[model samples]
Target: MSTSVPYFHHFQKDTTGIERPVRFTFPFCYDPHELSILAAEQVQTYLAGQNDFIHNFGLMDGQEGLVIGKMFGVLVVQDQEGNLGFLAAVSGKMAGSNKHRYFVPPIFDMLDPEGFFLREEEHINQINRNIELLQKSAELKELRENLVQCKKHEEQILSERRKLHKKNKAERKERRIAQQPCLPEQAYQELLEDLIKQSYRDQHHYDVQKEKSTQQIKLAEDALNHILDQIEELKSERRTRSSNLQNQLFDQYHFLNARKESKSVLAIFTESKNIQPPAGAGECAAPKLLQYAFNHQLTPICMAEFWWGSSPNLEVRKHKNYYPACRGKCEPILGHMLLGLNVDDNPMLENPAADKELEIIFEDEAIIVVNKPAEFLSVPGINVKDSVQTRIQNRYPEMDSPLIIHRLDMSTSGILVLAKSKDAHQFIQDQFIKHTVKKRYTALLDGLISGKEGLIDLPLRVDLDDRPRQVVCYEHGKPAQTKYKVVSIEGKNTRIHFFPLTGRTHQLRVHSAHQKGLNCAIIGDDLYGKRADRLHLHAAFIQFVHPLTKSLVQFEVKDPF
Candidate 1:
């Protein structure tokens, strides 16, 4: 009856160069030094008992926990390459060797539980206080709601009061008409009764509001006391464990709770007008739009999940990996947030006109298409030196600048399109997003090809270390398809036409280089082709619907090379 969770998987290339998967489990925690020896022993025992293939043991990062009032990490075998060199700091010491001849203490030596308990005590106390305040505020809010209800009824009461006043005035006005005053005593008695009733109703409504307020106050007080008691218990326990901890109190780690809100106005130059973040302007590492919204107390509507990837701000959520020892958890303490503006803000881009020349192939009121050469950027970077977009802007200063609806690889030279207005940009962008638009490319390959036309369907995912290079991953990769037709076959080069149905990072290069027994690779693809002048793929044809006209439009260009 073994109870352990498998957190990671193992993979290796088979004889045919195809990836094969194997699963393994690791202990929740492991001692760094003894993990290797223990894992080796476990492997030997497993072989002796069951004679299973048991290729290797799996190990993972160390975790911290408390058992029977003592703090210790679990020691377990790591899967594949369970060498001591791979052992990292699990619970009680800094990762790597701490053999430096210095007065400083090892990192993990300071990670005792005594200090953590104290910090937990403080946090509990603070939370309890916050809960009490929240309760009081809620009570006040309820009272305000009641007051509001009373105010709404005031309109009806005021109307009735006016009607009564008018009736009394009319009766007085008709006194001359009813000169026969036999019922004067009766009329006076009626008036007195009405006055008494009005006074009673006003006093009753006031008393109801007061009573509700008093009841709410009592409820809030009770909740406050309960929260206070819980905090007190936590504090007392922490105090008792203070001796076992390296420090009396654990260092407080602050996690700011971003408040959610919306804004009506967004300044082009400044942030949202009304929202202000917990700290002004620069606390988070997000785009300007995100930062501005954060500053204004507007929470991010978007959630990002990060790993070892190129995309920014993608990180693990709080609830996903609660264990303190997880790598995802450690990365946060080491790397803070980085901030920039939207896609248009290429802070690193310089002026494009300073370097290579840009050739505008087509321009109109709706769209501006260019034959962008290689080494020229698709959009402006920080300083706007020589990006395709900047060049177009610099050349046509008078034309309302075109917005980049999409992007192309910087090293890739091909036909590029830009929208003149937001409507056009949005419309074209939607087509690209839906994969409704058609894109054709011309590429010269590394080897000859005899196929007239063929389709390749291989899933693609980021490589482990070098994410820019897409790899074949049948398990986790996204579906990608490309159709190719051989146009001509030279001695060692094959010119081909490619049609990609899906848009991934490097779908064409990865698919063409698949181990399907052909040496053909796109020219100039150093990552995939290894040694090439350039990736010979060119964007030759683009077709989509016109944003304003709703009419089908298409553009094509002959390969310059």
Candidate 2:
């Protein structure tokens, strides 16, 4: 029997009424099934008490080394004999090793001492050390300094000589102009010849001095170039070796599907996007769990992944929160591994606003204000073309430029304004750009808060790994600000009013859920928090200057929730 068979853990508690899912959990987006959740709980218990490995999860104050939280996953499986159990795996390496007793082993163990990866990596490190020593050597440093000084000295000498020559020429020209009328013809010719001779002598001197300085600079530059040439050659060699090693590593990562078909990381990515595989391609928890189950002949029922410790500085990750697989690295790999197995339908493909209607609040010759319902799209999407813009164009065929001035999130219900003419669009858009337009939103937070009102100044950017989801990134994010006032407290929920100062994608949602902001997710925010029937956020009021009237116009809508 394979050594990995022991890693399969049987459920310790009674699972009497737990039902099995008919389809496998969609790795991209899903609610954790009961079996998967139970397996994850058992894995968490083991993590809390385990003493076999050492990793800093930032849970304690005195832990050494860099504190890095990790994502863990569990797969509910049934063996050939119908014995129910689960397999555990973590993303990337844990405790500087991939060989843990309770977790499934990595598909390719590059850290093994006997592996080719380490051997090539050591060779690369030696090249780097040689380059560093050369760069720091006193001889190379002196050569560089000498070259700089030589060039400066050459320029100074040439400039001084040119200035002297200019002064002498000017003096000679004045002497000729003044003395030409005073002297006789023979005397004047003699004076001009003498001046010509003086000019030739000065020119010869400047040329000689310039040659000497040029030679000195050339000698210094030659010496410096010799060392730089060597360094460049070493760098070129290192780059070639690194590229070859990365290609070899990618070739070694072969993934298996449920149908027993195999494909390497390089080949799979090439077939999908015609690009190289991203870093940490097949090392995530989902791929490792699926690979192990397929190799062991275990039937995969469902799976779930969750964060286990402190959140990363660049991304928002709460402890013990379930998350979907990342699209950048794991999506392509999982798309291949989940083959031959029935999976749940992707909920994102379905149009949520198919049955919703757009209610017009007010209309005029230049603009129209409408109450957009929850789950309705403000604009057309890739799969769904039915949106507010499309509907407006259909209703008013003669309306030129039916421009959508601003947008609300597809899940958010609110008052949306549209322009019927180009002039009106530009006028209203200028107000938004200048931050003169005022907007207020009503939302129901999932938790209660003590503060009546406060300002949130967290910056936001899209999580590149997961599309449509936003993260609080201070380094490369746009400024997003919001002011909120608590309206009422109902049971465990709190109704609040949000006044946005700047507009950014998912600005309000991330601010509500991020720890640095309110630390309380808005109700029914599926991306950042738990999903409910619909998002509780609604745009209640909007105020802006009218185009034709040039007067301040405002509109309001009552929140349904």
Full-model lDDT, candidate 2:
0.91
Name the 10 consecutive residues with the lowest summed lDDT in model 2: 1-10
For 297-381, candidate 1 gives per-residue lDDT tens digits of 3322221111110111111111111111222222222112112211122222434336567777777788888887765678765
Query: Residue 48 CA error for candidate 2 (Å)?
Result: 1.7
- Candidate 2 segments whose C-alpha is farther than 4 A from its true place: 1-4, 126-144, 182-187
Question: Best candidate, TM-score-wise?
Answer: 2
Per-residue alpha-carbon lDDT of candidate 2 for residues 1-561, written as tens digits (9 for 90 to 100)? 222476899887877689899999998879899999999999999999999999999998999989899999999998888888899999999889989999999999989999999999999999898889889989899999999999999999999999999999999999999999999999999999999999999999999999999999999989998988888888898999999999989988999999999999988888887988988899999999999999999999999999998877766677788888998888888999999999999877888777888899999999999999988889998988888999999999888894799999998999999999999999999999999999999999989887899999988888876777888877888899999999999999999999999999988888887878788889888777776888899999999999999999999999999
lDDT at 155, model 2 = 91
Question: C-alpha displacement of 395 in model 1, angstroms?
Answer: 3.9
Separate clash counts for every candidate: 35, 0
Model 2 CA lDDT for position 237: 85
Candidate 1: regions farther than 4 A off: 1-354, 381-385, 396-402, 516-519
